[model samples]
Target: MLFRSLKPLLAGEQHLQLIWLALGSVPVVEFAAHANPDALVLDLQHGLWERTTLEAAIGAVGMHVPVIARCAENSHGAISQALDAGAASVLVPLVETAEDARRAISAGRYPPTGKRSAGGVRPLRAGLEAMRAADRDVAIGLMIETVEGVENVEAIAATAGVDYLFIGTGDLALSRGTSDSEVIGRDCERIVRAAAANGLPCGIFTANARAVRQAFESGCRMAVSANDIDLVKEGFLAARKATFEC
Candidate 1:
């Protein structure tokens, strides 16, 4: 609940798309939180991070902006743990059907709305009100990553409690067996349309700022602007060239 409210996103304005910095370490988390992009993405799905890292990152961020955890899978444990550790949002990956979307939603919710038990570390520290407010505060992002996912995009988007529909272009390409630009464009369009029809925002994963901007033009309202490793690599490469080149 410490992360900023989801008012703009919930209000459905074509406002500035949130540029989130992805990170998995304490120092990087603190730096990114200080730099203060739209939000922070903890890459549990693909990043080599454990539970302790996520907890430390959450503490470092301390609600400057939303800290969203992109979980490893679409499961209750994965979804709920991130929420319980005080992630304002959770991104569930590899979702292929409406049921997969539904399961993710149910897992993150409370008893009446979901099966998630109410014992998050942050919530406990904040006392009763935070726990009660959690239902309204937690944002749920469901990823559409496979051919089957694309085929059922509309149904999945229409599922309840889905705050956003995110496209994992890399995984989709792998699943579809081709990385053709045209095919990815078509897929992005379809997923964006699905989210629009369901009154939700759309997001995507991009490797660089050029692609991130292009995705916004293609109707994605948000993108992964940078990750810790990428930033370090880019900085080192630039410095190396500047220092060594004649």
Candidate 2:
């Protein structure tokens, strides 16, 4: 629970952070949290994960750090289930318009505001007050990956209840037909400015440490660095290199 208390403050301002899970498994996610990366993202969107395993993973990260899950879609039921199961926050992906952003937020929040159902168990049962506190401080990051999303960046950023507008650079670059371009720097800057203009935090995903730092300087407040398979692959590759050299 070293970084458990820091989540509340993340909601208060545009702060810098590193999200260490994109293709991570439960054990991998837990390990990263223990190592004290700023945060972790349980990617239900683009991974082979069962709901039960996902719940277990969330439990593992519970109270240790802010665990934000990326949902399969902006499915209200899935959002509600994740929240009730104790996810500190949700990141909805491929949001292409303000309406998409609105729906995603609606799925996460409760009534008078939105329609997240009331159900509690496991991690949620142990710390109701604190969980509510975390929800109040929850970071609902929306992924702006598509060309349509980039075009609608302003509108999406303007949507109420969107805490962070994450620039999914890989997908965005692919959509723009310039995945290899140095123009990414300029493109990201544009999106960052859009997020800033709407008073929302800006986030990005990059494996390259240099690019992560560059994103921070370029106004990206949050970033996803590495995931399970890739992290392990890199480590093994480095180890093999070191062993051969030695």
lDDT of 1 by residue, 158-212 (tens): 9988999889998999988999999978998999999999888888988787888
lDDT of each: 0.81, 0.74
How high a TM-score does candidate 1 get?
0.93
Q: What local lDDT score does residue 139 receive in model 2, on the 0 to 100 scale?
A: 61
lDDT of 2 at 128: 52
Worst 10 residues of 2 by lDDT: 1-10
Residue 198, candidate 2: Cα error in Å is: 1.9
Tell me the TM-score of each prediction against the true structure. 0.93, 0.87
Expressed as tens digits, the lDDT of each residue in 1-246 for candidate 2 is 212533454656545556655554677777787777777777777776677877778778767777777778878976777666667777788899889988988888766577766566753455655545555655678888878888888888888888877788888888888876567666777789898898777888877778778778878888766667677798999999999999
Model 1 residue 157 CA deviation (Å) reads 0.4
Total residue pair clashes for candidate 2: 0
lDDT of 1 at 138: 80
